[model samples]
Target: MFASSRKSSLFSSLFQTPHIICRGSSRNRVISGSDIAASSKVSAQWTRLGLSEKKPQEQKPAYATSDQRMASLSELKEIFRKADAVCFDVDSTVIKEEGIDELAKFCGVGDAVAEMTRRAMGGSLTFRAALTERLALIRPTREQVQALITEHPPRLTEGIKELVHKLHQRNIQVFLISGGFHSIVEHVATQLDIPLTNIYANRLKFYFNGEYAGFDETQLTAESGGKGKVIGLLKEKYGFRKIVMVGDGATDMEACPPADGFIGFGGNVTRQQVKEKAKWYITDFEELLRELDSDSIKMNHNDIFY
Candidate 1:
């Protein structure tokens, strides 16, 4: 009976697929293409998404040759020019590194977090446990985040500064909408001359002495579909006529119902689904800059009161 039981358990373990594991991260560091291909391929619930453009060569579509380039730049340019408010995703979209992951590396908890990530992926740990445990392991102090910024500033994507500047010049309101921590996103906003008030991201709470307490779970960005909710609030509060969201993720694309358009950016990193769905996809900000007219003035972003 003991031998039979062992054999049965082995068989079950080999065949069972578990769901509690961490298949997706907010930063999207895990889930590779080979893994995706091995997965059912029936639906893309937890696959074909990437933090970088390192997708399976087999999955890459035949290159489009509309001017031998990005097909919908014209449409994107139109939407961009007409937009009242333009929101950007921060981590991989505006900056090259993923903020939370960078914080982990800085806090000397990179290995621990990575192990938790592996466990989360392998179904040995629950997603909730993975997230909280990783946070606990990193417990990034207030000073750490600041020091991370000061010591090793996040790299901005090429042409992003120019893009934001031109949008501001055109009187198009630019806001940083991210699921990343406010501390990191704030730094990026400052570099771009974007106001702190214009940032919609998760906030980290701290003790009066500035020790890490926890992130504010109440923030709209702390939940799933939060970006969309924030865009809804942007419309209600600011009454924007036409808004555009630009980013490199599925969540960013999903925000387009609330937004007038979604522009896919692959300069820093490319995700498969984003490329396939984004009406206008570009790898460089110069593309948008080239499209933006110098004599632009339709809506005045400054006219709106904070």
Candidate 2:
């Protein structure tokens, strides 16, 4: 059934003129350069960090399959031509490691926490439950959290910096929305020059003595489908006409509706479900840049930041 649906979708895409309906609006419009230029820009409110030197030998994940890769790339080119706002999931999407897993490793519970994380991301376990169990095992300290930050700064996924820079130059609003902790993701946002206010993720709490207390359970991303809720909020509050989400998790797939498009990323980690369900999937960010350039969607440096 899925294969038949995909074939039908590909066939239709070949013949149909591309159009994206702006939700909460009356008219349907073809995606245009001018439309992208008019998208909203929101100020970010997170703390900035100094940029780190790029790793010269960062590892890349293997592609799930060659045939799936080709199809997804072809579809992604069309999607990119229409997107005005792109939200990136931090762990394994924009960054190489899962933040919590790294913390668990630091606390000497690496194997256990990693297995739980696998289950959570694979959709076999509820995210909140896995997180609760893992956190209890690790019980990270304030100093340990800082140590992880210092020793293992979130490594940027290949081509992510360039991708965000290009998107910004095109006057597109780029956001980093993660289920990861703010303490870690903040540094990543700073490195990418993404506004702190635009980042949405779980926040960690600490005692007055700087000991690890607990996470704020109230944040939307603390539970399942939180990514979708955040996407919906972005649409409702900002009035963005076209939004795209790029990630490597089941949660990222869940945001497809409010996002308008979902691009599964496998540069760091490849989940089979994300690869199968995403409208487009890719293992390299450069593929996205290439697609944009091929479609004449490239923006000059001077034309950006309007």
Candidate 3:
């Protein structure tokens, strides 16, 4: 009977494909049954969706040829001349990975959150609804999220920090708005030397006993189109004559109508909606700097925001 139960459990585990437990011997580590289940579930999900069902490759894409350049330096400079503040999306925009989704992985709810993220991003579900559902599933402790910071250091895309620095030097206000949690975004803001007050992202709520409670939906970014609303707010609040938004997702593309100029970053994941609609598309931040004529805008670190 016990053997039969074990077999059934194993089968269900495989179907659900939850988490993996790793064990090591003096010789080497061996994958356990739970690992198999998780792997199987992942495979099943991807297969059902027609996704590749494989880990993403780390290599970068080849640069576009000169003929493929969307706009010349002269054209970009004209736009830059009017822009006063630059707003950016955090995940897959300035950084290579999605922050909250990655945090969900650490909490053992990556698959579930990823599914919601997809629906929300693809315009099938409301951003807030998907976000609320995903956050509810994790119930992650603050410490667990902090541990993720240790496990997965937010990787800023090539030339991102330098671009932010340059923008700061040029007296432009740099803002990071993300659908990711504040706990994680705070670290990024600090590392980039951007003011914490200027960072707009989600903040998680906790119980008195340090248990995971829920998220502050008010501050958290709503699904994809929420970015456009944020752009509107910033424009109204700052009265900035020109606004530029940089991102690489469907949501970021929505900002085009609200923003004065939209710059798409293909350095990370490039969505067709964003690529097609963006005012300018560049693979990396360096391309933007080059297009903007970096030499003239370069200023001292402290010269920014003057």
In terms of lDDT, the best-performing candidate is 2
Could you give candidate 3's per-residue lDDT for residues 193-226 as a string of tens digits?
Answer: 8987777777676665656777665553754566
Error of 1 at 132 (Å): 3.8
- The lDDT of each candidate is 0.72, 0.73, 0.69
RMSD of 3: 21.5
Candidates in descending TM-score order: 2, 3, 1
Candidate achieving higher TM-score, 1 or 3: 3
Q: Give the TM-score of candidate 1.
A: 0.67
Model 3 alpha-carbon drift over 4 Å, by segment: 1-77, 294-306
TM for candidate 3 is: 0.69
lDDT of 1 by residue, 1-306 (tens): 001111121111112222233446467578888887866563454445633333566542122111322236566567687789999999888998778778898888777777776676565754344556777789876667666766677788889999999888768899999988777776777779999899888766666565777666666787667787788788878778678888998879887767767898898777888998888888988877876743232223445321
Q: Which residue pairs in candidate 1 collide?
A: 22-120, 65-68
Instruction: TM-score each candidate.
Output: 0.67, 0.71, 0.69
Ranking by lDDT: 2, 1, 3
Ten residues in sequence with the least summed lDDT for candidate 1: 1-10
Error of 2 at 222 (Å): 0.5
Error of 3 at 270 (Å): 1.8
Instruction: Give the C-alpha miss distance for residue 146 in model 3, angstroms.
Output: 1.5
Error of 2 at 120 (Å): 3.8
> Which ranges in model 1 have alpha carbons more than 4 Å from their true place?
1-76, 112-133, 294-306
Q: Give the per-residue lDDT of model 2 (tens digit) for 165-273.
A: 8788667899888988877777788889998888899877666576666776777889889998888788777777677888998889877666667888999878888
